[model samples]
Target: MNIGIIGAGTLGMTLGYRLSQAGHRVTVLETGAQIGGLATWFDYGDFTWDKYYHVILRQDEQLLSLIDDLGISPRMQWKETKTGFLWRGKLVSMSNNWEFLRFPVLSFPDKARLALGILYIQRVNDAGPLERVTAAKWLTRVFGRRVFERIWEPLLLSKYGVLYDRVPAVIMWATIRRYYKTRSKGDGKETLGYLGGGLKTLFEALERGIIEAGGSVETGAAVTEILAGEAPGVAVRVGDEIRWFDRVISTAPSKVLDRLAPETKLGAVSASSAPNYLGVVCLALVLKRPLSPFYVTNLIERGMPFTGVIEVSALTGTDEMEGNHLVMLPRYDEPDSAWFERPESEVATEFLHALRRVIPDIESNVERFFVHRAKHVQALWIKEPPKEQGPRHTADGRIWSVNAEMAGRDTLNNNAIVQVANAAAQAIGAMGAPAKAPTAAASRGR
Candidate 1:
């Protein structure tokens, strides 16, 4: 079989590698100059690291298994990390039970209610009922009005903006379950894993594996169109060339697909209504000194530009980064939000100004700063997300759409992306053989 995979990100590349290993001829097309998509990295003058923030939890079995299969498991490292919360103009620890007990954000009774709420959520094995309810309603009912207003609402607003009110409770339930399962049993601390050289190493290894398995990867190859082939396959237009393949797997966003392959009516994949997406504007900084002792600090206070401050150096270490602290300040908003059009320097200035509230002396420890923007970082899962409408096979069955957002059982992450890609490959394999050669009329139409 001859296969064409659009968007050579981790999902696309992984699919290409798997199909190639199955003895199929594979070719991957990538629009960007680099491959990893959201997992891609940038090269600073002194070093190179991920453009966006990504951490692996011990519970990420799908991602871990993929790493082991790529023969890069030895390069993985784990670190015990702490989390902090900024509330009422004060930073406080909340990583352990003792610190949580001492947290001044809520009263004693409120704290007890919060613990019970978490336990109740963890006890529910099925998420179906939770999906029918909104996070606001669920939290308010379980944690009471005070906890919901003080903690849950602010966090939801930071991530989902105005759409937070309609977000499904199952999303929050899945998040709590994921982190709860990743905690260390000995001390109840969270342990996060990272690749020694970052995700760049893992992506490069995947690319090598694809090539070794007889697949071709082309970057900066923007796909312009997808039309029905002369025979029973699909035809893709890359630049001025039109290539035919027995099957086409698209890992690009649904909007991108609707534009490229309108003939396929890919819009039906969303059942006419599309899922809302949140974009991220991240400011990565290399500091002369560390910002905080904790790896993650959730900002609960209002009037802050960024949601949270991630001091990745707490886990990645400064030695590999030439003794410079690496911090990421991520601002999530809609794609049409004015923040996306704001200049990078202006964004950096605004973020730095707000960051001072958490670190009073941060300005003095400056080094280098870079800003990165992703148009679609996360998909907002609605209470009734178009269930009957999602990534699926076209009427012809030769074209398929697969992406991280289509992950059924997990949230959008590298692990979920890999799982979706694997499932798509398996389905394609079961289809048997390549399409017959194009007919004379179809060839003339091209």
Candidate 2:
């Protein structure tokens, strides 16, 4: 089948790799200058690393298997890392069970409820029921109101604003299940994996594999229209000309598809059911000194401006950053938040000023700083089994949705996305897609 994929993010790239390996002619289209999507590489002067902070857990089997397939598994490395919790003008390490017990902020009962709830949620094999339940209700029931207010509530507020209560419990369930990897070894330490050269290594290898396997990848080639052609053939508009394909799978947001895809063919989903996205505004810094001892310092203090602090260098090692440190202060702003439009300088200053309260020496230790922003990064699910997910294929059965909540309820990660891509390929193949093109046709138009 001649397949056209929209949004060459990890989901798109992985889908392309899988489909090509399955003997389909694939062309992955990306609007950005490069692939990786959220996991794209950023230029940090002397070196480059992931555009946002990302990590690989020991349980990330899908991602690891893909790395092996790309012949780059040798570059993968694992290390022990610590997690930090900051509150009341102090930073505390919460990497181990003993530290969690000794933590002063929460009462013994609160801690017990929190720990016990996590243990229970981690073992739950089925989280489908959680889709209809609000995270607030589930958390309140399992961990008690006190724990919810003391710990999880602030995080929800910081990320989702007033819509926090509307978030599905499945998100929470997925998070706990994924997090169990850190302690599954029975050790107090949290071990994380990373490719030696960061995400760039993985993506580069993926692109190579896709091309070598008779697939093509395009960057800065945005698809503005996806109209259904003769049955089982789709027409994708890149510039002035329209290219036809046997099948088209889009990883773009539902709203985008609502505007671009031929709604009359498959019909458009209601706007109300599409999840609103939480865009992130981050102050990325190349620091002369590390910000905190932990890789991630969850901020719980009242009135804090940002969501959390991540010292990426802590996980990858400072030597990778040319002997400097890498820090990111990310704030997941609501859809209507002004941070998306505010001046980058102003946002950076505000984040740094608020951060200085905790790390008074922050500005002094910073060698370089960059403000980065990406809208539509994190999906905010307000309803269970979103209306858009009811049908993976359109009425014509030519267009398919790949990453659209069809990926199922899993914590947002490369590994989960890899598995989603694998599932998509298997489904497409099982449906008996047409024969692959002897050679990929060239994309026309500028």
Candidate 3:
């Protein structure tokens, strides 16, 4: 089978490796110069690390299995990470039961409701009902109005921005459940894992496996059009070059794939009425010292520009970064938001100014700063439940949609991505794609 995978991110390369091992000629295409997508590495002057903060959780079975398969499990580093929450201009630890119980913002009734709600939702097998309800409504009902106003709403604003009010409760349920399940045993503190060289190591390993298995991974090769003509195969155009493929598996955002391959109508995959994705703009900084004792600090300060603070070096360690701390201030919003259009220096300055409220002496400890942005981070499902819980083969049955929208009730983590990759591999293996022959999919392979 001559398989063309659009986007050379973790999912695309994983698919490429699987199909190539199955004896298919695979080609992975990426628009950017780099491969890993959001998980790609960057040069931070003294060191290179993941552009965005990523960590392996204790409960990330799929990701762990992939790492083990890559023969890099021995290089895995694990640590008990602390979590903090800011409220009323004060930073407080909330990683344990005692700290949570001592959290003053919540009344006894509020605490009780919050506890019971969490206990109930943890056992929920289906997220359909949650998706029908908005997060604001669900939180207010389960955790009380005071808790919603004081803690949840502000926290939600950081991630969802303008869409917070319309976001489904299932997302919040899934996110909290994912986070809590990762808590290490005994002390209840979450244990996070990191590779020796970070996510770049994992991505590179996947890329290598694809190439070694006779597949090709091409970067800076933006696939502009995919035409499933009246002919036998799909014709893909990269610049002026048009090539035929037995089957096309697009890991692109739903909307993007629709534009690339309009032949499918793609309604079964993503409709025109579907919600737009929430993009991320992160203001990353290297510091001479750690900003906080906790790796993640959930922000609630009303005027803070960014949502939360991630002390990535706390989990990754300063050893790989010349003993300098790496922290990221990320804002999640619409891709075309005014903030995204603003100057990078202006965004950095605003974020830094607000950060001082949490860390009074931050400027003195800062070493270097960088800005990273991604337009399609994850689909933002608002008000209504998604029509289909998983990606479907388009009407033509030639293009497979394996994107984030297919991840039912799960957070956008590497584990979920690996699960999607494995599922797609199994499904495609059952299909009767064209016989394995010349590598038309990667005719211009690097």
Candidate 4:
């Protein structure tokens, strides 16, 4: 079988590797200058690291397994990281029971309730009922109104904005469960893992494995159109040339597919509606000194610009970063938000001002700064069993759409993307011969 996979991100590349290993010929097309998609990296004069903030928890079995298979497990390192919360203009530690007990934001009774609520959520093996409820309703009911308003509400508002009320409870449940499962039994502290050289090492290994398996990986190959081929396969137009394959798997966003193949009945699978995505404007800084003792600091203050402060240097050693701190300030908002239209200089200045409120002396410690923006970093999941639920295969089972937005009941992360791609490969392999490629006459009939 000959397979053509569009968008050479983690999902696309992983799917390509899996199918090629199954004795199929594969060709991966990517629009970007490099692979890895959201997991891609940027070279800072001194060192290269992920463009966006990313961390691996001990509970990420699927991601860990993939790294092990790629022979990069030894290069991975684990660190006992701490978490903090900024409330009432104070940065307080919340990584352990002691710190949490002393947390001044919530009363003692409220803290107990918060702990019990997390325990209950962790024990919840089935999240079906939770899906029917919104995070606002479910959390307020479980942790009470005070705790919800003080702790969770601000965090949700920061990440989801106006869509905060529509976010399903399953999303929150999955988040708590993932972190809870990663805590060490002895100290009950969270431990995070990172690769020696970062995600670059892992992505390079996947690309090399695909080529070694007789598959071709092409970057900067923007796919303009996807049409029916002359035979029982799909044809993809990359640049000016059109190439046909026995199968096509698109890891691009659903909107891209809607534009390329409007005749196809995508139904609810298409993300052509408003409030479907959450964009991110991230500011990463290479600093001469560390910002905070914790790896993550959730801001509870209202009207703050960025969501949280992710000090990547806390989990990663400074030696690898060329003796500089790596900090990322990410703000999630609607794709059409006025923030996206702001110039980089304006965004940086505003972000720096807000950041100073958390780290009072951060201005002088900065060595270099860079900004990155993504229009569709996260998919808003207000609907139960997302419109594009289940395997990537469409109704006709010829073309497949696999991307982070399609991840149901799971957060959009590298591990979940790999899981989705693995499942897509199985479904595509089990299906019958590819459907007849759409010819001009056949396209008109639809």
Candidate 5:
């Protein structure tokens, strides 16, 4: 089969590599000059970093398998990672069992109840019919209003904006399970791994494998339209040229599908179900000092703009760049928010101000600062217009539609690469082709 994959991000690359390995000809069309989409890296003079910070957990089987398949396992190093919460001006270390008991933020009884609730959630395979339960209500029932307000409430608001109230409890359960199941020994510290250079290294290897396996990859190619082919194929118009394929798999956002195939019923599938995506303004600082020892610092202040701050060097255990520190200030807003329209300089200044408020020494230690903005970084899965309204995998004869929501619903983690492979493989089989089975040798990372 000749397959054309739209959007050469992690999803596109992985699916293309697998299909090519399965004796199918695959071609990937990428809108960006470089690959990896959200997980792509940007060169910072002496070093390269992801456009947005990304780390893999121990249970990220899909990602880990891909790394080994490409013979990059030696480059993958695992480290026990720590995460903390900044609640009501207090820095609370909440990464371990002992820390939960020792922390002064919650009363002893409140802490016990919270701990028990987390343990219960972990043991239960099912999310307990949480589809009807809102995150705030469920959390308050288990952890009390104080913990909800001081910890979870603010984080949800910062990530979802006004839609926070509508989030289902199942979403929180999925997040907690992913973290709890991946925890390294020694309390609740979770093990995370990073590629030798960056995520881009893994992406590059995958792209090369696809090309070597009788596949083609083209970047800066935009598919303007999706039209039905003369026979059993799909035609995509990239600039002035039109290309035909036995099947077409789109890893592009579902919203893009709605725009391209408006005449087909495929557009309406996810039109009303477009979950809001929060924009992230990442600030890379060549700092004189580190912010904190913890990798992630979750802040909970109502008026504060930034939701989470990640110190890259502290997390990686390597200070490759002199005065090296990369801080990510993620702020949630609608796709069309005023922040997106503002100049990058203004965004940088705002981030610096917010960052300095939390880390006082940051002002004097900073030597260089660069900012990158990701519009619609993640799908607002937990919130409005509710989970039932989310995008469903629909086919209008030839065109296939998929995005974060579809991936999250079908797979364990809505990871970019995994989603692409799962969605594309499903699309291909649905198009009258023999079901492509996962090669055991390939799955074993041989």
Candidate 6:
């Protein structure tokens, strides 16, 4: 079967590799010069680093399995990571039960409520009617207003801007539960995993697998339109050439895909109002000394223009070629936000201000800085939800839709990838002599 994938991010690359290995002709269309999408890396003359802050949870099995499958198992490394909350002009360690108990911001009763709320979310499998339920109202009701105001609201406002109230309570619960489950032992310490060099190694390996299996990956080839006149096939427009495929799996954002597929009324798959994504300018510093021993710090003070989840270089256990430290400051806001398009000097001033507050530093110790911005980081998908509508996957005859945002229930999990891969295979495989027997859906590929 001829399959065309719209994007080449981790999800796209992984799917392409698996499907190509199943003896189908696979082709990937990437608009960017490089692959990996949000998981992409940039070279800084001396070292290569990710444009935005990225770290894997200890439970990221798909990434782990992919590393080993590519024969790069030795490159995978893990470390006991620490996180802190910056509140009232001090860094309060919040990575453990003991520290959480001692944190001074919340009242004793409020702290207890927060604790109970965390447990409730983890234990409760079904979050009933969470769509109509807003996170702010739900949290404040369960954990009191102080917790919501001090910790939760700021984080939501930082991530979602004015749409903070639109986030469902279940999202908040799911995020917390996911975080709790991925910690180190019983201590609340976060465990982080990183590939030796960067995720580019993994992306390259997946690319190789796809090509070796007779799949073609076309870079800088953006599909302007997808014609679905033929049953079980799509006509993709490339410059002047039109390529046809038996099936199309779009990993591109639904907003982008909606424009490409004109034959169907894509039913709110392309949202009327875009959900806000923070534009990030990552300043990767090769410092003479490490900034902080901790891996992440959530900015709690108001006036600090950025709330970055910092990644200390030495912690990821990568080789320090120059014996220098690596640190990244991620600033999230709308693309049109003043900071996103700020002049270099103004942006540098903000970076220095945030750094000085956290790290006791000499201005002379700075080594390097780089800025990167992703226009559409993640789908805002800001609909009121018991059921949060991402992209709609209408069964348009032979045109089967498999996108990252539409992979139901299991998100960012290896199971989700495997599930979509199997579903697409089955959907396409059932289409007569045009296809071959694909691998059966399993937790792990044989």
- How do the residues 1-446 of candidate 2 rate in per-residue lDDT, one tens digit apiece? 88889988888988898888889888898989989998999999988989899989988999899999888999988988899988888998888888988988799988888878888887788877888888899988998988888788877776666678888888878887787767744656788889988989988887888899888899988889886745646778987777777788888776777778746433255355656677888889999987878998887776877888899998989878899999998888776788889888898888888888888988899888888888877766666655444337765457877674554466567887788788888887777764442233533331
lDDT tens readout by residue for model 5, 1-446: 77788887777788788788777888899888988887888877667777777777778887788788888899887777777777666567777777777877678877777778878888867664776799889888877888787677887787667778987887777777777776755676667777777788888898889989888899999988877634455678888787777667777777787777666655565666665565666666666667777788877777776667777776676554444676666776677777777887788788888666666766788777777777756665653343443224334335565455555422233254474475566556555542342232322211
What tens digits encode model 3's per-residue C-alpha lDDT throughout 214-237? Answer: 888888889998877653466678
Q: What is candidate 5's CA lDDT for residue 203?
A: 87
Please give, for residues 1-446, the per-residue lDDT of candidate 4 as tens digits: 77889988888988888888778778999999999898898997799999887888777788899899999999999998999888877888888778778889989999999989988887889888997999999999999999999999998998788788999998999888887887776666888989888898888988888899888999999988888544576778888787777778888777777776666645234554422788998889999988888899898988778888899999997988989899998999888998888998888889999878767888898898988899888877677654546555556666777777767767768888888888888888888565554343532223
Judged by TM-score relative to the true structure, which candidate is superior, 1 or 5? 1
- On residues 325-443, what C-alpha lDDT tens digit does candidate 1 reach at each position? 89999988889989999999999999999888767888888788998998887876663566643457776677888776677436667877877778878888887765474543553
What Cα-based lDDT does every candidate model obtain? 0.82, 0.80, 0.81, 0.83, 0.70, 0.67
Candidate 6: residue pairs that collide: 131-385, 131-386, 278-333
Q: Can you list the residue pairs that collide in candidate 5? A: none
Lowest-sum lDDT 10-residue window in model 2: 437-446
TM-score of candidate 6 on Cα atoms, chains taken together:
0.86
Which segments of candidate 2 are over 4 A away from where they belong? 264-267, 270-272, 386-391, 434-446
User: Between 4 and 6, whose lDDT is larger?
Assistant: 4
Q: Model 6, 273: alpha-carbon shift in Å? A: 8.8
On residues 1-446, what C-alpha lDDT tens digit does candidate 6 reach at each position?
66788888876887788787678878998988999887887776566766555666666665666677778889777777878777776777787778888889888888888888877777778866665688889888877888889888887776556567877676676667767876755766667777777778788888999999888888899878777764544567877777776667777666677788745656244455444344455556666666666788777676676665575674664363345566776666666767767786677677777667656573567777666666665444445421443334446443445565555323234435545554555555555333332222310111
Tell me the TM-score of each prediction against the true structure: 0.95, 0.92, 0.93, 0.94, 0.89, 0.86
| Clash total of candidate 3 | 0
Give model 6 RMSD, 1 decimal.
Answer: 5.5
Cα misplacement distance, residue 409 of candidate 2 (Å)? 2.7
The all-Cα superposition gives candidate 2 an RMSD in Å to the true structure of 2.6
By TM-score, who's the top model here? 1
Q: Please rank every candidate by TM-score, starting with the best.
A: 1, 4, 3, 2, 5, 6
